[model samples]
Target: MTHSASPFVPDPSRYIKRSSREVPVGPVTIGGGSPVVLQSMLTSDTLNTEACVREALDLVEAGCELVRITAPTVKDAANLRAIREELRRRSCPVPLVADIHFKPEAAMEAAQWVDKVRINPGNYADRKKFVVRSYTDAEYASAVEQLEDSFLPLVELCLRRGIALRIGTNHGSLSDRILNRYGDTPLGMVESALEYARICRKAGFHRIVFSMKASNPRIMISAYRRLVATLQELGPDWNYPVHLGVTEAGDGEDGRVKSAVGIGALLADGIGDTIRVSLTEDSVREIPVAKALRSLVEQFATAPRPRDRIVPPFDPFSFQRRESHRWDRNPTVGGGEPVRVAVLEENLAALEAASAGTEIVPELGYQPRLVEEVDPEDSAALTALGGGPPRLVTIRDGCPYPPLYAFRMLAARIPAHHPILLKDTFFPGEEGDPLRSLLNSALQLGALLCDGIGDAILLRGEADPRKALELSYNILQATGNRSFKADFVACPSCGRTLFHLQETTARIRKATGHLKGVKIAVMGCIVNGPGEMADADFGYVGGAPGKVNLYVGKKAVRFNIPQEQAVDSLISLIAGEGKWVEPPSS
Candidate 1:
């Protein structure tokens, strides 16, 4: 595999955040050495002035630095004026962002009322009909001209109004032009945003931020890294603030795990200027999670690291599993096998107690005496170990570098296929807040896993062995490394949602939680529903108020079923597709 000499993060030795241009959204500033800002979107309809105002206040009170409201049409965009007026009358001055998709007029109108306006590059000036066609040089240049015509007005307007613009791109919503050229990859996501960014820069408008969002954590992580690298390649002044998130991350533990893995990884890498944890619950509920993750990054930033800089061993832009030979036959540890989940237990009795009666047992129980542990800084020792027969190797506790860097250093020194076991912490007995540990583990381990570094993971900081075992599997699932249960891609509710998303998501999960390895998507609207859920096995989407649409892999077979009967119909659809199985009795 080809490797980049420059590290993905700016400074591997310390938490030196990427140097970026500060963009002001109202009074709050992002990037330019600013502490990462926290933000969330309102679920209340834009037309409901009172509800929108109340939700905005609630989010601000819950520590949301910026609030976003959806404006799907010109009328909805106009309503943002009322929401803004109401918020100001109540003395809540949190800067508001208007989310616009497929509507340039709405973006223009929203810009008049809000502090910032967000436009999805995939749909801002382009249509998404999933059409497949080739664009010649002439056709492509014409498309770019059309995009400039549609987007330049907004750039000019935002410049005059002193409003910031977020050129956000989603994985599933790439325009046919981008898809045909870039093929729905992370590179496509970054290129989509940069196309609009080029227009803003040409207009001499610098109040801009960017987000590369996806439901899958691995894709989200890679897209952000690629965006940063691409921006670096463009020029020194091209460093714009970045907003990080994993969109359509479902509710509860699953949602938190996914968000932490994606957002936390980037934060640890010192790439994000602002962050939002997109949970499919009340918008206010998202703040605490974001706060926890931010706190973890802050603490890591303050902590000391070795003076020497070490380069990353693998490519950060793409997911290429490191070549490794088969190290074990039973519950395989390497050789193109699924990443194994393991636990750090002293003996068999403790392992039994922790994983007893659990189907998701650790494949390997690591005891210090049985496995070889090498000093992370000692490359000579690691090379000597690599010269011998392949055996399980890991960083010994108390490495000078941080856990994340220590592992990267080890990966660099060892053979490509050494089957290294990853741990959340390299230091023993360093424990405090459970939430901190959870987020830290996700950030460090998730960062490595997404980089295709880890073959096995151990949650060493978690004291509760059962919880540790469960979290290890959750991290694996969130990183898209493995799936022990059904997978979900549910979007956080916004003003465009037609029905209660939290309740519907719970109902669907209850019915299908038993289907192992099944990938399902629960979306609130078609704004991003059909495209975002393209990789899902089945889709449960809101068609309208109390209405639902079901799809079997990008094709909607059932439309406008009443919300109450939608779950049953979905089950039947799954069975019809030969994917449904009866749940095992408790």
Candidate 2:
């Protein structure tokens, strides 16, 4: 891949953050060379004014730059006015964003209250029953005209009211029209957002930021890269800011891993201006996660290198591990093996107990003093082992490449064959904060693995070594690096769920947890079933009430199986495919 140069940045910086028009949302400013902003959503029901106000205040207190509340209806959009007023009264004047999914009227109404309005171009004016039809060129143009007519009034009103718009596109929610023509691909996601962006531009409205969100990090990264490249091709005058996120990213370590993989990969390329970490936990808790991820981005704000070194070893626009001479250093790591796990905890005994065969780099002098390069003698001494020559599993570095720019500079100087253990120190926010430890480790390490950069992941934390090891593998598995056990790609149940998602997911996971390397998806509804499961090996999606549809890859193998029998049927399907081995009886 070659780096394309442009005039907007003059010299070395053009290769960094893609230039975007400075979009203002009340007191906060993003894009146009502004610092990367952090955002989160309010989970309280929009009708519950007290809860909504309370949640907004809590998020702002936690360093949330922009707060979005779901406005699924006109009334919910109306409640935002009181929520905004109350938050301001409480001295929390963070910019409010209205998340409008389907209703154009709600978006118009929300613009009257919130500083910014985020509309999903996928579901704004189109439907998603998963049907396909051919569209003639004339018919498509007419559809565009109708869509523009529907959106122009809001654009006009937003311009008059000084409100910003985010034309966000979701992978699972693409309209049938876009899907029919482009299929469910990254190009489709980009086109879906650009369709609205084109109309907004025609109406002389420029206060727009765009996002392409998917549960899968690879697709999310590719789409954002393609979107930026497409905009550059369109012209520098079409500069628009980008908001980065990965939607429906589950919960706990898995969610954090998925979100980090998608969002971090883009930020490393200097592509994102504002970021939101979508977790299944409390919205206020999301702020810390966003800050942790953004730290890496800020650390590498400038272009890492003059154009040539801009792209990493592998192509940034696609997924391909860099070419390297294999090193069979550790049994599970290096030599083209699946990415390995390592730990640097204080308790040597606990570390040994947790990872029987895993490598443990000493904590002393691990944090780099120079931040760039270390003396060669010191590096060699650190990696020197008593056992016949140091293996590739262990690496000695001056400092951690928390930012991609640092990584690029160091990778250029280091040996390609030597396996490197990327490190991130996990920080649990406060005492008694559940999920904090897991989320911190996942986002920090999973970010690099998603880009196919690391040979092994190292999480330095104070938890039990076994827990840290488990968290390391979970991060790797979530980022498609390694799988130690069955991977459950379940969605956080929404209102349309047919069965008890939490209990059913637990049951399915327990029953099949022994099947190593198998990816099983348990989705709550047809709305988020197949598309959301993207690369899952098998799927158990909600069909009719109490019935589940089973899938192999994207094809449904069984239909309408009773909820009580679904888990067994899934097991049989796996056995029939030679993927199931009976769990040893305790």
Could you say which candidate leads in lDDT? 1
Model 1 segments more than 4 A misplaced = 11-14, 329-331, 346-358, 428-431
lDDT of 2 by residue, 1-586 (tens): 2234433223222135667889999999989888889998876678889988877788888999898888778998898899988988988879999988778998999999999998877677876666878999998888878888888898998999999999988786787888899988888999999899988888889999999887777778878877887888889887899999987676666777787778876776678899998765667767887887776556555423433333244454567664334544334445577665554434544555554543322222222331222322234543343234223433234333333334333333355555555665422223433344454456456655665666666665425556666667767777777666787777654334578776887788789987878888888777567766767889999998999999997778899999999999999999888899887575
TM-score per candidate = 0.96, 0.76
Predicted model with the maximum TM-score: 1
- The collision pairs in model 1 are none
Give stretches of model 2 more than 4 Å off.
1-18, 89-91, 300-311, 328-335, 342-395, 399-445, 457-464, 488-586
Deviation from native of the Cα of residue 120 in model 2, angstroms:
1.5
- Candidate 1 has its poorest 10 consecutive residues by lDDT at 1-10
